[model samples]
Target: MLDQNTSAQLKTLLERLESPIEIVATLNGSDKSDKIKELVTEVAALSPQVTARFDGTNKRAPSFGIAKVGEQPRVNFAGLPMGHEFTSLILALLQVSGYAPKVSDEVLAQIKGLNLTSDFDVFVSLSCHNCPDVVQALNLIAIYNPDTTATMIDGAFFQDEVEERKIMAVPMLFQNGEHIGQGRMTLEEIIAKLDTGAAAKDAEKLNAKESFDVLVIGGGPAGNTSAIYAARKGIKTGIVAERFGGQVMDTMDIENYTSIQKTQGPKFAAEMEAHVREYGVDIMNLQKVSSIKGADETANGLVEVTLENGAKLESKTVILSTGARWREMNVPGEKEYKTRGVAYCPHCDGPLFKGKRVAVIGGGNSGVEAAIDLAGIVEHVTLVEFDTKLRADQVLQDKLNSLPNTTVIMNALSTEVVGDGSQVTALKYKDRATDEEHTVELAGIFVQIGLLPNTDFLKDSPVELSKRGEIVINERNETNVKGVFAAGDCTTVPYKQIIIATGEGAKASLSAFDYIIRSGQ
Candidate 1:
């Protein structure tokens, strides 16, 4: 199942095995089963520490399980682990063979302390860039705790199960046969869900921390850059975010960042987090700031940040890097059918609607690019644009127009997402030119409208904001508040590129430092 170069690479990676591993396969007299057998046999031949056995009673045929010798299999694969999932397969092998995972000590302890028995079945697509994170996270939990078991099921290979469960998105997780979550989720998020008391404990710990010299709110590219810059000044810097990596985690590919030719979103976010850690920046992930009080509004003359969990933190200066999120259509049935048929990330969820008709909402670059990409997978793509003309670049519009399976509708506004209480069946729109309404039958709707700044928490705060709800900032990225600064998509920046966000973050950090020095704080 692996090529020459792949086999050599696998052989080299397997040399790190600390103990013997057994690959047990459950197969039948089918082509897929035969392929699984060959894959397991080949993998076994790569290392003396690995052995293959083709006798098992798993109901899912053409499946395999990896485990250390004489131990129950903790991680199982229901289909061929190739494409984006090949890394998952390798991680499972090494982790099950007594190799430690690359997680923090606290996280490792939490996984090992879990005493309950739980089963996780993650449905994924091979082309999805976000699937590997969920797959590898569950595998790590399964390896550390013998009571937990995780199975990575490729949705493409198991179409019957996918349809039966009505799974319309990739990386959908089901715990003990009950739906839990969907889309991109990190290992920390998975644990936070499993551990009920984790949030309260984290809040208590955060409340007990001392005041920081520079405290950054949000964990996107801007927040990470701000924290790194502030920490490099030898100041006590702490960053709190709802989720590290922000919306970039949902992004698939990023090629616009200069110096780096191309990189995936999750990989780039991981690199950013690693770089921030090198500067000793206090990183707090999975924390949501409910509100902020500037030094002018606080009794102690210190910038005060409040968490959703009632945890209060004080800082000398604050940098607001809270980024933006995908704007919703706000029409009926959109919320009810989210992840059922309404998806935001095309690259992650497009494979789930193979050969089915779908609609792309928006006429800009993202929308046209999604339609063009989905044309090859889905039966037909209908691009609905509210504008009179397509706003995408000339080349992108030309390519989209050339696609035979794609249709573009101009001056149309999406009215409602029609669904049958489970999944979407059609979309309702109105023609601006004739006041006529229309409906298009489709299996999925991809919303790429625009972005809304994540600044609702600051609506009542002292920081000045623009009419569009974006944080208003001057040339130096300084907010109207004396000690507060803003940057990135949350600010009134013209462009929302990643590189621009980083530069703005650096400027905001420097501005905050200057404020601190001038004010003798």
Candidate 2:
């Protein structure tokens, strides 16, 4: 049901519709479908120009076909567009009603010049905040170019398509049936993909041994800084990463980055990318490292990095800066409700649940801190801890105790997430002491247990890793393996902040340079 305030806002926005837009929907009579239909009807009621037609007989549940009245329907919503995806739905309606997307003339010209047919099938969920950006960008391109078509497919509704593609993440892009990109991508990046058929065109499998003075294995803050520092020293530098921004791209607020009062993750990532690209470093984005061989194991007497795409590159020194990712609870409904309600990033998804009750699982520093931050925005917060007492600092516990809307539930084990087919509704847990099961009815659940280092790929290698899987590095960011260094959250660094990672990256690069000078290689 649309609130009074939201209904008024939608009514105001819908007045901008220049032409009549017909929304043809396919509903399977499910609860989610009924809700979607009601929502669409409510939007249609706001304006006589906007109307909706339903097809309840269609086998594909929770799907809708949208188009202008005179032209063919070129857009489809595979699931109910709620949460952040509602923006995409509204943008689609506006675009179909004859409003042009806000794209530059130069980009339009470049899009017009393309002879190839670009078909983009973007997989997204309703709760993903980053999906709308990618969808809107692609849809804008499609609107400007006759040869391009962009379709937003809801991952939850399109189970067959999702299973066939093995999509585990949102904002996954498929170009002409090939999985081209995943996660949030800029418009410039999509244009680049259109120009080059492959996601990592610059990282095509190398046939012969190509050596570099330094090779950075990740593209996070640490790896990018390492590459920039090494390139500034006039060395042959190369960086291979699954993604350019690493975990920093998922971060929403960055206040303690030194000097900067406030910044977001994506913006900081772009700045870092621009800074690194200013140097002569060869960067291979979206390339996953399959295995690595130390300098002694390589036949060419150089450390070798093998990519999942069968690319091989050798370097005198290798710096591993693969950052850490949020640890999953591995419980039922955790994976299914991901983004919809079971969110790992509090900063990124906190705003979506404003004024709604939510739970923060884990009573550690991150969990308690996230609870404190969310209590101010949300109606109420339930902090659940598995331990007998909160493991956070005393100061943080005291701060949490002061929040009026915050409820601390100690010695509770989260069992599962309770939700309908469309969205999350509540969380199921059990008391550790009494073994009494309880359910907390809430709109969202933020999991802040801990982080796991992204060094599983190095397990087969000779790289020395702690029992917890973090790479062990010395003060100079030098790993036990000769000519191979590690830094950032992936390493056993004392601090995992951005500033510390940047400093460690610089130290690793300088150490590599010193080793090269001493070895005369």
- Model 2 backbone overlap count: 0
What lDDT tens digits, residue by residue, belong to model 1 across residues 10-110?
99999999899999999988888888898999999999999999886767787899989987787999989999999999999998998989888998998
**Residue-wise C-alpha lDDT for candidate 2, range 1-521, written one tens digit per residue:** 78899889888888888799887777776887887788778888888888788853333567675667765455666677777777877888788787866665866666656555677788886766567778887776776665666778876667666655555456778878887876677665677667654434445645353689999999999999999999999999988878788888887678998899999787798899889989967877767899999888877778988888677888999999999999988888988877567777665466556678999999998899999988987899999999989999999999999999999999899999988865678999999899999999998889999889999999998999999999998898888888899989999987789999999999999999998999889
Best by lDDT: 1
Error of 2 at 64 (Å): 17
C-alpha lDDT values of all predictions: 0.92, 0.81
Colliding residue pairs in candidate 1 = none
lDDT of 2: 0.81
Model 1 spans with C-alpha error above 4 angstroms: none
**After best superposition, candidate 1 residue 398: deviation in angstroms?**
0.8
Positional deviation of 76 in candidate 1, in angstroms? Answer: 0.6
lDDT of 2 at 443: 81
How does model 1 fare in lDDT? 0.92
What TM-score does structure 1 among the candidates reach? Answer: 0.99
